[model samples]
Target: MNRRDTILVADDVEINRAVLRSIFEEDYNVLEAENGEQALFLMRQYRDSIAIVLLDLIMPVRDGYEVMEEWQADPSLRGLPVAVITADDSVESEIRVFDLGASDIIGKPFEPHLVRRRIQNIVSLSQRHLDQDDCIREQARKLRESNAAVIDALSSIIEYRSAETGQHIKRIQLFTRVLLEDVAANCPDLGLDESHIAMIVSASSLHDIGKIAIPDAILNKPGRLIAEEFEVMKTHAVKGCEILSRLDRMGDRDYLK
Candidate 1:
């Protein structure tokens, strides 16, 4: 869909190469090689742009097997799919080509429609992999943005509820984030990234967010809590967990932990 994909056709016969090229040239950028040696050279020269290869088994100098081996050995070329196009339709030929990493096989007297279909399928699959990678990157970006907003909101909630200065929440958040990073580095099993650390620090601010639910008489008391008042104070952790846990906005409980 981006543009007509390029294909390299490797065959010893000039007539076969010409016919194949004529069929594909309308929808593809075509390159031809008379033998395996030329095919490998063209592949290297146009490695980035070429999408697939239509290879023939019998050729002078280097054969198809040797070329396939060379392609598989190179890390850059290893994943490029090759469809073997040869006159040999023997069982041994099919098995050998597949073992050598040919993704597909097309017998000689090449059917134009079948050749077109196989090439399209390989190119489509490659494009799908590219699309999936793009989707993953986009999702990661959105997750980071969501985590940042949650952290800011949690910090605001803490500042609003506490008698301490507004900067108190910000300081505590930074301290918690540093502690989380230290833990993550010292303990690789935690698998914590910067986003996870941010979530944990943000959720830590909400550790006392349930205080908003408590009565002012108990919350703003200047004196130490009596037994009855202490009972009310102990409820904050559970109450905080309940309140934050119910919110669809928060990501996971590890942050609350």
Candidate 2:
């Protein structure tokens, strides 16, 4: 009952357009186009607000196929749902319309109730997909925030057990982000995108986590380490690797790994 969403009806015949309008005008704002060119014009003019297109396959000027071809070619318009309404019920016509990305096809002399139901279904399904995508993106964002919090906590623990401070972890993430962003800009072939950079910057916070396992005497040494103690300090790298190996087993927590 949301009259805000518009339905486009493109047909060369006046009676056909009038009949279709009567069926949908009660629930939706109907935009009528007597030719394909007019239909395309209306679509471009109100692309974002139009919920679904009821296209006639045999319209003049551009025709339905031409309109569909243009729609499919434009990435921005390709996702909008369309339904073909025509007298041509041939299998070839159906296959051609489907191939051109129509969501449904209704033969002419369509039952008013059936036509309305079919168009409603297509719009409803499309809206559901858009809603689901929004939900997924929200969940992913929350997951990323949770992962960052846990990483920061673990890094703080490592700093508490060693000579390092919280600023050290901050500096590591900052410097890693700077370098990765440079790589993304200059080395496009490497395919280092924003998400990749974020994951790597987060992982850098765990670089010295293995120090948590080293003895306090060696980990927080006041002076320079001796050769024997230096060897023990170097083992933190291997220890960090071991700790991370355990994280790999956490299902759907690849960010931790």
Candidate 3:
């Protein structure tokens, strides 16, 4: 991604296009479109590259109004800042541009310094918004990794305390991957995408987690358990649910039970 700012100047009048480019070219990579058709083509090709669009309302072959309409229909293009440059300086013209959701309006003939100032301010603000979104996404990724690590460590501790091998927890994770893959393949109704499947694999260690609390005599005895012992063994699922309920923000607890 080219993070440097780019400005697209779209005008039918060659002189007007040159003037706007001269004002912005020193600070930004400037692109020119002689007509609205060409403007739309450039915008599509370099939507992510461009930060601000300088649009001329009265251009030949699909005017600025139509270009605005096209970009506004698609979410990606809609967020880019658009400054309407118009020969018509009437209050009605400015109001219409505002109604069409332009970032700013410039009237011809423009002072180069004022044009420079407006583009600089708008591009700076747009860059800040993109930076904030990137920060939020990074924070979310770190949080998920931390939570997964805590689950893995705690589950391993549970397995060790029961005189069980770590392989017990490993098998739980492996079986969970199979079940989730089946859900992805055969059950569109479940709506379980890869992210949901990933959480399942991370948290499957908690499925037998409540076995940590059962008496060793009932849990590890080689012989058949009596009715009372079997009933006690059954309680591990409920105990697992109780453990989940005690935890903060573990999402849905029904899966544990």
User: Positional deviation of 25 in candidate 2, in angstroms?
Assistant: 1.0
Q: What pairs collide in candidate 1?
A: none
Q: State the displacement of the C-alpha of residue 217, model 3, in Å, after optimal TM-score superposition.
A: 21
Rank ordering of all candidates by TM-score, starting from the highest: 3, 2, 1
Which 10 consecutive positions of candidate 2 have the poorest summed lDDT? 248-257
User: Candidate 2 at 119: error in angstroms?
Assistant: 1.7
Model 2: CA > 4 A from native: 1-4, 147-257
How many clashes (backbone N, Cα, C below 3 Å) per candidate?
0, 0, 0
- Each model's C-alpha lDDT? 0.78, 0.84, 0.81
C-alpha displacement of 230 in model 3, angstroms?
A: 22
RMSD to truth, every model: 9.7, 6.9, 7.5
What is the Å distance of residue 135 in model 2 from its true position? 1.3
Q: Give candidate 2's root-mean-square deviation (CA, Å).
A: 6.9
Give the C-alpha miss distance for residue 36 in model 2, angstroms: 2.3
Task: Report the Cα lDDT for residue 99, model 1.
Answer: 90
